[model samples]
Target: MPKESYNVIGVMSGTSLDGIDLAHVVFEVSDGNWTFDIEESQTISYSDAWLQKLKIAVNFHKDELEKLNSDYTILLGETIRGFIEKHGIGNLDAVCSHGHTILHQPHNGFTLQIGNLPKIAKIAGQKVICDFRVEDVALGGQGAPLVPIGDRILFSDYDYCLNLGGFSNVSFENHGLRLAFDISPVNTVLNFYANRLGFEYDDKGKLAESGKIDHELLSSLNNLAYYRQSFPKSLGFEFVKNTVLPLIESFDVSDIDKLRTFTEHIAVQIASALPKKSGKLLATGGGAYNRFLISRMQEQLPQIKIEIPEKKILEFKEALIFALLGVLKMRNETNVLASVTGAKRDHSSGKSYEN
Candidate 1:
């Protein structure tokens, strides 16, 4: 008989460079339905040195990138080990990790996530399931927004699941098919501007709320070509570094105004991407805390009701989903949705190493 439950640790690092999130979770199945309990969770802030290295890793040469990948694997292993020790956690089925993304160009048929080497299982002293996106890319998919499957299974109460993470992405059902795509850049761009102002992030979007909106800059941002593209699409730091940053930097506005304008852009993009009918929209990820941004979004889509979950889900939802992804892989069940990622077919993804 198959196991009815799994205890796992999920690890993730987003493009925003906010930090690495670790969640200890237990998933159980009953009557073909799934539920989870978040046992423990923490976010370990990255050091200045590591933040710089990861930020520039996309520009690294092949050799340098290989070394960086190896070092990152070690760092991730040590981090997971520490979390386990701190919680005195034992009997984990696996440690599921979405390593930091260095390069994500699914259109070019490649996406690289560091810290997924097989040795991580040995270092962390547990079985591991990771490198979840590579296979989907190999099958001609965007290799992103992998959380929708979890949304479908564990959070079906809502009509939409909007994740305001490093990048904003949404998942929902349309005509019996699960559809999802990246809405726009969220914290990935907001945090960059905030860092320039000597703050890690715009607390409650207070700085943005105080600044004036640059309508011209906002218009240009709204007209970007990516917004017009259809579903099964995604964005990465490359798009932000090459396209978004350059466009935003070309303006002479103050950083505060830039923040204000960009926050409006995010709100507009999110509203435009969502269906305009009355429904429940479950918003999660770090951006949910941005009161100003949420207010703008709510104003734009008056019919949609946005629900902010508890602190654990708001912060560690991605990590929690990755834990579920690991459990599915252990059971050889479909974890990545072909409809969401535009893959060749629905399939079980990720590489598993039993230590």
Candidate 2:
């Protein structure tokens, strides 16, 4: 018989490098319907050493990355163990981790997410289900925007589910198929410029609001080739490093103007990508908290109703969905959707380790 409920911890480290988000979630299935409760949650910020290593780890040679992977697994295991002990969280069926992404160029037929070493289960003293994206890539898919499965199952009430994290992505049903893809870079770019001004983030986009938009910069950003690409695509730190940052830097605009112009670009692109029909849009992730960005999106997408959930859901939805992914893996059910990722077919993708 299938289990009706599962208690799991979902750990996520986004490309934005904001922190590692951990959520103790309970998933329950009643009458073929699913529901989840985030019992406990918190984000553990990375130390300067770890942050610097991860930021530049992409530039490391193959051998260097392998060594860093080993070290990162240890750090990830330790961090998860700390969270478990601090919360006194018991009855954990497994720990589901979306390890920090180092390289995500699926077009090249490979992707790497660190911290999924088998030793993690030993260190955390729990079964671990992780490395969820590798198999999809092997199947010739982009292996990204994996959270759409959760949107389809857990939060189906809304017509569209949009996440504004390091990058912006949206998931929605179209003609009975779930479709999703990355829209544009978000905190990854905004926070970079914010750091230049000595702030961690723009703090509700106050800096952007204080500045004027640079039309030339905005036009250049909107015309980028990625924006013209079709679905089954995703963006990564590499895209920002190779495409976004250099383009932004080439323009002679104040930091504030750059921020503002980029913010507008984000709004315009998101609005353009959204479905034309009116429907509810559930917006979450860190960027949802950016009042200025949301306002700009609203102006561009007046037809679509935007809904921001409670604080817990806003900040930890990705972690919560990773927990759902774990639960699906435990049940031997498909957790990744081929329609969304362009994989050969739907499949359950994760490596399971017994402690």
Candidate 3:
């Protein structure tokens, strides 16, 4: 008989450089329905050196990145081992991880997420499931917004599931098809300007609240071609570095003003992407905590009720969903949706390393 329960740790590292998120979850299936309990969760912040390394890794050459990938895998393994020891966790099925994304240009026929080496199983002394995106890309998909599958199964009550992380992506059912795509750059750009002012991020967007929005800058940002693109598309740190930051730097405005304008830009882009019809929108991720940004979205989406879930779901939804992806992979079930990613077909996507 197929297993109906899984005890697993879902690990995630976002492009925002926020930190590594670890969630110890128990998922149970009954009568074809699934439910989950997040027993323990934590976010391990990266050191300054590591943060700087990841920020510039996108520009590293092949050989240099190869070494970085190996090193990152070791670090990732150690982190998982420590979490297990600290919590006295046992009887785990596997460690499911979305290794930090270094380069995600699927249009170029490739994507790179470091730290999925098979050695991770040896280091963590447990089975591991990871490197989930490469197969989707190989199958001619955007290899992104993989969380939508989890949404369709776990949080289907919401008409729309919007995750505001490094980038904002929304998943929803359209004509019985699951559709999702990256909406716009979120903390990836916001944190850039915030870091310029010696802060990790704009607290509640207060700094931006104090400044005036530069309409010209806002207009230029909204006009970004990526926003005009259709579903099955995604954004990465590369887009922010090569296109977004340079454009923002071209304007002669106060950093605070830039923050304000960009915040508005995010709101506008997200609002535009959502449907005008009335429905519930579940907003999660670090960006969901930004009260000001959420308010702006509420203003533009009056008909669409935006709901920020509980603390655990708000901060660790991706980790929890990634855990679901891992479970599906173990069952040899279809986890990547062709409708959402524009893949050639629906299939089970992940690498399994049994120790």
Q: Give the lDDT of residue 138 in candidate 3.
A: 92
TM-score of 3: 0.99
lDDT minimum window of 10 residues, candidate 3: 269-278
TM-scores of the candidates in the order shown: 0.99, 0.99, 0.99
Q: Give lDDT per model, in order.
A: 0.94, 0.94, 0.92
The clash number for model 1 is 0
| Lowest-sum lDDT 10-residue window in model 2 | 271-280
lDDT of 2 by residue, 1-355 (tens): 7899999999999988989999999988988899888988999999999888998998999999999989989988999999999999998899999999999999999899999999999988899999999999999899998999999999899999999999999999989999999999999999999999999999999999999999999999999999999998988899999999999999999999999999999999999998674889999999999999999999998888999999999999999999999889999999999999999999999999999
Residue 123 of model 1 has an lDDT of 91
List of clashing residue pairs for candidate 2? none
Off by over 4 Å in 1: none
| lDDT (Cα, tens digit) per residue for candidate 3, span 179-295 | 999998999988988999999999988988888999999999999898888778988888999999999999999999999998999988988997645799999999998888999
Any idea what lDDT model 1 has? 0.94
